[model samples]
Target chain A: MQQKQVLLLTKSIKEKAIKEFYSKERPTTLCIADLGCSSAELNTLGVVAELIETIENARQDLGNGSQEYQVYLNDLPGNDFNTIFRSIASFEDSLKKQIGSNNFGHCFVNGVPGSFYGRLFPTNHLHFVHSSYSLMWLSQVPIGIEDNKENIYIASTSPPNVTEAYYDQFEKDFTMFLSCRSKEVVPGGIMVLTILGRTSTEKYSKESSYEWDLLATVLNDMVLEGFIEEEKLHTFNIPQYTPSAEEIRFIMEKEGSFILSQVDVSEISWEANEHYYKNDLPKTAFTHYDFVKCMRSVAEPLLVNHFGESIIEELFKRYLETVQVAMTKEKNVFINVTVSLTRKG
Target chain B: MQQKQVLLLTKSIKEKAIKEFYSKERPTTLCIADLGCSSAELNTLGVVAELIETIENARQDLGNGSQEYQVYLNDLPGNDFNTIFRSIASFEDSLKKQIGSNNFGHCFVNGVPGSFYGRLFPTNHLHFVHSSYSLMWLSQVPIGIEDNKENIYIASTSPPNVTEAYYDQFEKDFTMFLSCRSKEVVPGGIMVLTILGRTSTEKYSKESSYEWDLLATVLNDMVLEGFIEEEKLHTFNIPQYTPSAEEIRFIMEKEGSFILSQVDVSEISWEANEHYYKNDLPKTAFTHYDFVKCMRSVAEPLLVNHFGESIIEELFKRYLETVQVAMTKEKNVFINVTVSLTRKG
Candidate 1:
C-alpha cells in the first residue's frame, strides 16, 4: 500500500518542481528532507533516489546547472540507525552509477534523530519536504480511548466518545506538525503529504474502519480458543487515525502557515499485490498467505511487544483464515489522500 | 595563549565581514564552521560566542535585519565529546542572556566528527571558517623523524634531515586542508587561521626551537635519575610543527583555491603571566612550584604515557628548575602568526 502511494507522491513532485525551481531566484544549494524516514533499506533508498532524480531533472530543465544538494533523513532516536549507516555507501554508489557522476549534483546525506513535533533544522533552511504513509500515526494513542473494548483502532464498533477522541487527537497533531515545518521551511517552499484517510466525512466510515475490525475479530477468536486472555485486547489501542479531506483542510487553514494547492483522493484495492502474481490467473486472485506475510512485516514488532514471541505463529495462522473468508464476500478498498501545500509568506 | 589569539582573529573577521556582506547578494542563512574544535569548554565556547556576536553585529551594520546561522563544530571522533555536549545548553543560554532572545538570530550548533583533511560538509554550504591553535599540530609525526634521539619535538640539536621532514609534512597536510575546504566553502568565503610559527626564515631558529630544547633537557635528566628509560625518549616525538610565513603563503597559492589577504606576526614574553603578580615581592619570586603546576596541567598526559605515573611530580619539579635559570638570562618570547584568506571565485 505504501509503495503504490510513494509512486503517486513522487509523480506529483516531478510535475510541480520545475515551476518551483524557476519561480524564485534559483538557490545555489537545494535542501530537501524526508521526515519519519525509517530504516527500511529498499523503500527508503527508493524514495530518496526518486526525489533526487526529479529535483535534478527539474533543475536541468530550468537551466540551473550547478546546484548542490543536502539531503537530511529524520526519524526518532530509537530508530535502526546502524542499519541505515551501513547501507549509505551502497545507496550513494548506486545513485552515482545510474545518474552519471558528472551529471549528478554533489549530495551530502546525513541522519537527524528527533521528533517532528518541534524544530529540527535551522530556520528557513529547507526548500522541499516530503512525507508518505507516516502522518496517519499520531504521536500517541488518543486519551479516553483505552476503554474502547476489543477494538484495536478506530473501528465501526467503537463508541461515539472514542471516535471524538481520535478526531481531536488528529487535529492537534496535524496542527503542530504544520507549525513546526513552517518555521524550518523557506517561504514559498513546497511540502507534499500522502496520508491514509477516508473518502466520506462520516464519523466511522466502513471503508477506513473495516480493516481494523477484521483484525479485532481475529483476536476475539483467539480469546474464545483460550490462546490469549480477553483483557489484553482491551488494553491495546493502535496509535493511528484516518481523517477526511475536510478535516485536513480545516486544521491546515486554522494553523495559518500554508496555502493548500491541491488535494487528491485515490482508491486502491486491498488485494493490490495480486496484480504482480506470475501465474496465469485472474488479476484479483491472491491467497491468504500473501496478505498475512504483508501484515506481519508491517506489524510484527508492535505485535511482538504486546504478545510474547511464543504466540506469534499461532496468532497469525488464525488471522490468515479469517482474512480468506472475508475476501470471498466482497472486495475491500483503501482510500489514500495526497495534499500539496506551499509555505505562506 | 589561545584566548588572546582568538580575540585578534575574531576582530579581523568583524572588519572584513561588512564588506563581504555588501559585495554580493546577502545570504539569508549564514553557515560557519570551526575546524578542530576540541572538547575544551571555556576556550571553545568563548571562541564560538565571539564569532557569533561579531557576525551578528556585522549583519546589523549592513542593515540586514534577519539572518539565521548554522554553526558546525568539527573534531576527531575520539575527542571527549561528552564534555562538549554537556556544555552546549549553558553556552546557548548565556548567549541568549547577553544578546536578548528577540535580537539574536536563530543559531543551530551541531558537531561534525571527522578529520578536516577530507570533506566534512556539503559543497558550497559554508560561508566562513575559523581555526585557532589547531593547524599547528600535524596529522601525525613526520616520517623518518622518530629516530631523532632525546628530542620529542623540533629542537636546536635536531638534524637537518629532521627539520626538512617536518616542513615537507606540514606542506602536504596544509595543502590537503585547503583542497577540502575549497569544495566545502562558498566562493568569496573568508577563512581566518592563527598558526604557531617562527619569526625568522632559518629552519632551527632559537625563537621557535628553544622551548622544546628546554623540555628535552628535563626529560634527559629524568632518564639519568633512573625515573624513566633512556630508550623511551628516542621513540617519542610530538606531532607538532611551526612553519614560517613564507611557507603558509606558498601553500595557499600553490593549492590555487584561496588568495592571501593579510598576515600578522606578534611577540609575547613567555613570562607574561608574571605581570599579574602585584605589590611587594621577595627577591626570588620564582619558586619552581608555580612553573611545575603550569607545565603539569599542559604536558602531564603526554609525559605520563611515556614514563610511569610515579615519576610525574619529580619530572616537572626538575623541569621547573631548568626553566627558572633560562628565564633569568633573558625574557623568553614566542612568535605567533595570524593569516587571513579569501576563497577564489
Candidate 2:
C-alpha cells in the first residue's frame, strides 16, 4: 500500500520542501517528520528514503548538496521499532551509494514513539510533516456507536445513527489534530497527508463498505459456531474512519490553522502487488490473500486482545474466503485521498 | 548508580540552561537529550525526570512556567527502548504530580537508536546533553589485544602492549566522541557526564581487577572441565575501560571543543542497592548477587554473540560463585567520576 504512495511524496518534497531552500539561506539541517509511521521491516523507511532522495536531487540541481537531515519517524509505542532500527545501518550504507559521502551530510534518524493526535513535538520545530494512511484513525472508537452491532465500521448493515456518530468523531478528531500540528510546525512549514479515505463525491461510499462488511461476516460465522461470545462481538469496533474530501476540507476550515493547497482523489486496485501474498495459491483476478494479510496486520492486535488468540487463524481464513466471494461479485478498489497544506501564521 | 548521579545534574541544568532564558525571549520549547540512556525498567527515566524537575523549579523562580520539551532518549540500537517507552505514561503522571498540570507543558520524548561515536545530531541544535555510565564503553574492543589472552579486560597479568592498545583505543574513541558532540551541541550549551572510572591516585586501581579476574577464573575452570573452548575465551574481551579523571581531562584538552568546568570523584559501595539482588541469599557483607546481575546484562550479549548459547547459564552460574568467593576476601567499591563541561564556540 505504501509503495504506491511513495511516488506521491516526491512532488511534495521537491516542490514544498526542496525548492524553498533556493530562495533562502540553506539551513545546516533539515527537520522533517513522518507521523504514524508503522514499521514493517525495510518497507517502513521507503517514504523517508524517497523524501531524502528527492531533496538530494533538487539540491544537486540547485548546485549545493551539503545540508544535514534530522528525520523523525513517529508511531504508537506498541510499534516494532527494533526491526526499523536494526536495518538502519544497511539503509545508511545504501543511501551513501546513491548520494556520495562527500555530498551527503549526516542524516540523523530518530524514532518518536507516541500518538500523533496530541502534541508530538515542541512548537515551531518541524520544517515539514508527512502522514500516510494515518490521519483517518480516531483517537479512540467513537462514543454513542456501541450500538453499531454486528458491524465494526461504517457499513450498509449499520444504523444511520452509527454513520452519524462516525462522522462527528472524525470531524472532532481531525480538528484536534490540525490544532495540535498548527503549533508544532513553523509558520511556513508545509504538510502533505495521504489518507486511506473515501475519495468519492458521495457522503456514503458503497465501494469502501465491502472490505468492512466482509470482516463482519467472518466474525458472525465464528459467533454462530460458538467460538466467540455474542456480547464481545457487539462491543468490538475499530477506531478507524474513511472520510470524504469535503468532510476533511470542512474540518480544516473550522480548525483554521492551515490552508489546503492540494486535494487529489485516486483509485488503487485491490491487487496492487502480487508479491505481497504469502501463500503459493494459483494467481486469481482478486488478490484475497494479499488483502487478508494487509488487514490482519491492522486488525490482529485488536482481535487478539478482545476475542482471545484462539480465533485469529480461523478468522483471517474465513475473511479471505468471504472476501474472495465479494470480489467475484463486483470490482473493488481502495480510495486514496492525498492533500497538501501550508501552515498559516 | 544513576540514582546517586541524579543530584549532580540539577546544578548543570539550573545554572547553564534555565538561567539563560531569563535574558532572551522565552522560546516555546526547550530541546535536550540523554545519551546512552540504558533502560533499566523505570529507573531509566530517573535522570530525565530530574532534568525536567530542576528546569521547572528554575522556571518558577524566574516567574515563567510555560515551555514545551523535546527530550531525546538515545542509546545503542540493542538497548531495550520498548521498556522505556512502555513506562513513559507513568513517568508523565509522576511528573504532573511534582509540577502540576497548569505549569507542566508537554514533553515530547524520542528514542535515538545509534552510536554516539559518530555524529548523532546536526550542528548547533541540542541545547543540552547528558550521558551516564556510557562513554566508558568503547565503540568496539581494541585491536591487537587478542594477545591479552584468558582475560576479558585490563588485568595485572596482561602484557604491556595489551594495556597500550586499550589506552590508544580509548584516546582515539574519546576524541572522536568529543569532536562529534561539538557539532551536535549548541555553543555555550552545557553537558554533564557521569562515568564509571578508577578514582584512586594510582593509574591502575587494584580494586577494579577483582571483577574481571573472577570472570576469568570461571572461564578458565570451564575450559579445564571441557565445557568451553580455550580459543574462544581468549578472543572475547568486554569493550570497556575505566579511565582516571586525569586521562579524561588530558583527552578533553586535546579535543579542544569543550571547557571542563568541574570534575568530581566519588566512591559508591558495592552494595549500593540491596533490593537489586534478585534472590534472597541471606544478609551478607558484600552485594555479590547484585553486582553479578549487573555484569550479566552488560556481558551476556557480547558473550553470547562470540561464545555461542550453550555457556551462558553455566557461565553466569560459575561467575556468581567466583564473585562470592572474591568478595569475602576483600571489600570493594565502584569509582564514579562526574564531570561538567560547556561547549565552546
Over the stretch B1-345, how does candidate 1's per-residue lDDT look in tens digits?
Answer: 434544554566535653464346467777788878777534776666776776666666666686677777767655554466556667878987876546676666655556787677887778888887678888988999865889877777788899888888999999999999998888888788877788888877878767778888888887888777888888877777888888899888999999888787766666544544445765346444444464465577777776769887777777788888887677666677778788899
Scored by DockQ, the top model is 2
Q: What are the lDDT scores of the predictions, listed in order? A: 0.74, 0.78
* TM-score of each candidate structure, all chains considered together: 0.64, 0.92
Clashing pairs in 2: none
Leading candidate by lDDT? 2
lDDT of 1 at A13: 51
- Cα deviation of A259, candidate 1, in Å: 3.1
List model 2 lDDT by residue over B1-345, tens digit each: 434534453345334544453234355667788888877735557667777777777677778857788888888887778778877878888888977747678988998999989888878877778877888899889999878889888888888788788888989998998899998887777787877888664435666556777888898899999988899888988788788889999999999999988787777666664554545454454546767787887788888899889999999998987777766766677777778788887
lDDT, model 2, position B307? 85
Model 2 per-residue lDDT tens digits across residues A199-293? 66654577666677788888988899998999999999988889887888888988999998778777776766445454565445545677678
lDDT of 2: 0.78
Candidate 1 backbone collisions, by pair: none
Off by over 4 Å in 1: A8-13, A18-25, A58-64, A81-89, A101-104, A214-235, A268-333, B1-30, B34-67, B73-173, B179-250, B253-345
At residue B228, what lDDT does model 2 achieve? 85
